[model samples]
Target chain A: MSEQDWRAIRAEAIESLLVERGLLDPADVDRVIETYNDRVGPMNGARMVARAWCDPDFKARLLADGTAAMAEFDFGGAQTEKLVVVENTPDTHNVVVCTLCSCYPWAVLGLPPRWYKDPAYRSRIVREPRRVLAEFGLVLDDDVRVRVWDSSAEVRYLVLPRRPADADGLDEAALAQRVTRDAMIGVAQP
Target chain B: MDGIHDLGGRAGFGPVEREADEPAFHERWEARVFAMIGAAAAAGAYRNADQFRHAIERIRPDAYLCDGYYGRWLAGLETLLREAGIVQADELRARIAALGGDPTRPGGARPAEAPDRVAYPPAGEGNRRSVAAAPVFAEGDRVRTASFGVSGHTRLPAYARGRRGTVTTWHGAWVFPDSNAHGRGEQPQHLYTVVFDGVDLWGAAAEPGTAVSLDLFEPYLTAWTAEVDT
Candidate 1:
């Protein structure tokens, strides 16, 4: 069967299970699912970046205590306990991956992009970070050492992307324009 | 199944695929829970956000129980409502059917909210004690990967441990919660990295031009010099 056909079948099966078990009303599940697809994603991280750009003290706090620092902005949830924030500096670059599974900082960063959870990206990036970054349209100089973080159980990370050069004088929204999800993941720089 | 970080060097995978509009189920639940708690607090159901926050805060530290705690609360609410005849199983099913397809719709029996709050205790709090900064080495300093016995979850991959390399960066002192998280919280050590030549990792058979780096935690290393001690 086609992928769409399979999805339809899966949805039907899930609906049947929900009804039989009476775990949740299907309509409620639908609504919850919609909100998730619409509002969540790297946009969450982009907001964090914009806040960091505008506030130095908060940024310092973010680097020092990532979970607490993020709490000031009201960004925390279940699965956020293992949070560890990594920053990018002039000489060092930070990229995050879960080679085993898609363990991510869901609370602050929202849900991860599909590419992040892909097996292809997970398996190859750690061993060949430079090559993978090149494919993502990022080409770093040999002198700028590349450090790939293998985020596993107990600790998950979010990359504090270096601010973009062209974003000077831009307000939060405008600065947010430059903070792409790729930049946060260290695949690309803003 | 292998733990999530074990995917490196595996074969038969295609190039990465990016999904434009997809969110995991747990994340959706988290957001919905947050909103529900926020709205409830706003409605004065709880004395203050702190009260609600305190309730959750008490349970957040139990890593294993975190996920199931919310699930149980939701289940308990539904059960009470059902037992009191406020809502029937068939009625809930019918409402679901009436809503039709499109799971992304807004408003329904399902809650749409984020958690009340998520907190990570301050560094070196509770069971996590701060480690005194070890002056092992500095960036730009060349060092060799010390040969050490391996057990537990280590940042040092088997392929690169016990290899020689240069110190490219210092990651600062961490709680080393790997031991704690794994129920082996005896000694939480600091972690670091030393970038090895690709030749050192893959041996002489490796391509001469390539280079590799390994982030070695403090416990995995010892002092090294260029000259042989013998």
Candidate 2:
């Protein structure tokens, strides 16, 4: 059967199960899941990055220790692990991927979107970071050393991409407006 | 037994075929289990004895998957208890009352906080030092990664340990606790960086200028000068 057919079958099965179990109201679950997928995923991490850019001290703390650094902004909720923010400077560019699994800093960053944790992305990115970033439309010059961090341990890392050149004078909230989750992962720059 | 964070480069398992939709079943199941455990303990149905024994039994299964499973299980348990009306605010209050101020253990009235070593401090604050942060060596200082073989959970990746590197950075002290949570108690040790030249790590074929810096716990390191440079 086609991929579309399989997806449809799976959706129907899940809907039937939920309805029968009374664990969820079908319409409400659909809405809740949609909202969570769209709003509560990468956007959260983007906001944290913007906040860090606007505040130097906050950025310093984030670089030093990610979990505590994130709590400063009160960004994470229950699922968020302690944040470990890795920074990307001119000399060194940091990229994050879970080689072993799709482990991410979900508390501050929200959820790991589908693409970030894909097997294709995880497997290829670690061994060939420069090439992978290029595919994501990020091309770093030879001078910049790419450091790929594997969040395979207790410490989850966030990439503090250098503040965008055009973002000068932007306030915390305004800067946050421009930061995308992709930027923090070094796959895309704001 | 294996710790939750121990899956690294293990071979042989083909990707388990899973449905594209319906929120990964494994993820949901694990979350539910964690939540149930937390709720059960909170309701006084299980004491520290039960909680630890269960944790020990459940801890070693697929390490990569267990962390999220346990985390979600705790969440599910909390949600289930609240919904079932087995616990209310007053009951929560009473449980604490019964424990009489020491809420550190399971069923002690207070919910168990994430253990100390695993708990990071609030942002903008210095990381809590556990005696593992201080470095006995400095940059250009020669040292050897511990030759000790891996047993249970170890942070020393197989490829990196035992290879010599320089003390490039002194990550602040941290409590090793020997285990993920200091629940096993504190085995405070200093963390340090031993920078191994690419040539050292990959051998003669390594790129000329490449170097790998590793953050190592103190126990995993030892002082070695040219005297023992074999």
Candidate 3:
């Protein structure tokens, strides 16, 4: 616990205060920090989307078996274990919302944005998805069929955002970098 | 008995505001509370995730929405820990005082553990499990959700109750949350994705071709008959 932990002094001080206050324990605090630090976030989901866009085989496997295909990229954990990938197309747009609560695929997209968890979002998205999406700056065509997926329970859904036109010459990594968390959540286009 | 937590299509909560870049834990206390709940679950302090959610659902309607997200998490954690006998109420009070906050108001009484409480599972796997029973409804079948008010935990949203919709897909049978929350049993039931026309749920004001498709358990729905009730 010496020079090995650069902020050992500060960390120890905070832990001692927390323990003294009976709010938490020394070891549990460490575990808490560890969990937050290991997050794979939307970048991991982006990698999956980019690879899928580049490879038909990967795309088919991803659309068919999200969990297994995800494991191929070595991204597995709590909520990531069971995921249903919903793809966004020109004619049909898929939007994901957990009206009951903020039940999202955290493994791929990370912790839901505060907006996603807001009661306003949970309530309105299912009822008025176009209005909600428009507020998010995503305006769909009147012809496009908007499918709002209310993940009210177990299986989570992640949108495979349509690959952008300018992405013609980009490779997998560049395409992955272009994939934003909002796009994966189906509120924005990549 | 429809709790405020069942909010799906009620009105005027406000607009969704997106933050430019949101961090996982906004405050140190938030992180601590989040980890404490996880650790408590890891230490067998509570029955299951549904039980924890039920505890949150049981929060007073006024405070349910008032207690912000992590604030509700803190409140719920306090309630569960005290109820499970893992931490004393006074001990929590003292800690709350030490943190310069009032502990006297900690979301009311300490809830009791479920009568059928069992040992926690090894992994992070939740109460969800497979049910081998045949489904009563299938994709493309019109079904009407049962509009029963529950005095206890339920996954059915208030707006969808009594509305009729077509089953878009049968998501197999999964652990029933309503029963699982009470330690009644896993009681796995068929889960389906039901799609409702906007007007069916929201009346004539809804957009012309929009619809809301939600995943729901079989217990929440009934077979819609074509014959009109005279």
RMSD of each: 11.3, 11.1, 5.3
In lDDT terms, which candidate is top?
3
| Model-by-model DockQ, in order | 0.19, 0.10, 0.36
Q: Local error of candidate 2 at B221, Å?
A: 1.8
**What's the i-RMS of each model?**
8.8, 12.0, 5.7
lDDT tens string, model 1, B96-143? 455453333221122212222112222453222456667577887766
- Kindly report, for each predicted structure in the order presented, the TM-score of its chain A compared with the true chain A: 0.90, 0.81, 0.84
Regions of candidate 1 where Cα sits further than 4 Å from its true position: A7-11, B1-5, B11-14, B19-230
lDDT tens digits, residue span A20-46, model 1? 655445466556556446565567778
**Cα lDDT, model 2, residue A125:** 53
Q: Clashing residue pairs, candidate 3? A: none
lDDT of 2: 0.52
lDDT of 3 by residue, B1-230 (tens): 37677778867987887788787766665666666777667656676667777777767777767656766666676666666676666765665555544445434323533344545342225535666678999879999998776766778888888889999888777777787777676788898889988889889878656788888899898888777422
Worst 10 residues of 3 chain B by lDDT: B106-115
**What are the per-residue Cα lDDT tens digits for candidate 2 across B60-175?**
34432423333323333333333335444354444444534322322211233332222332223222344523467666677888766543334565545567877765656654
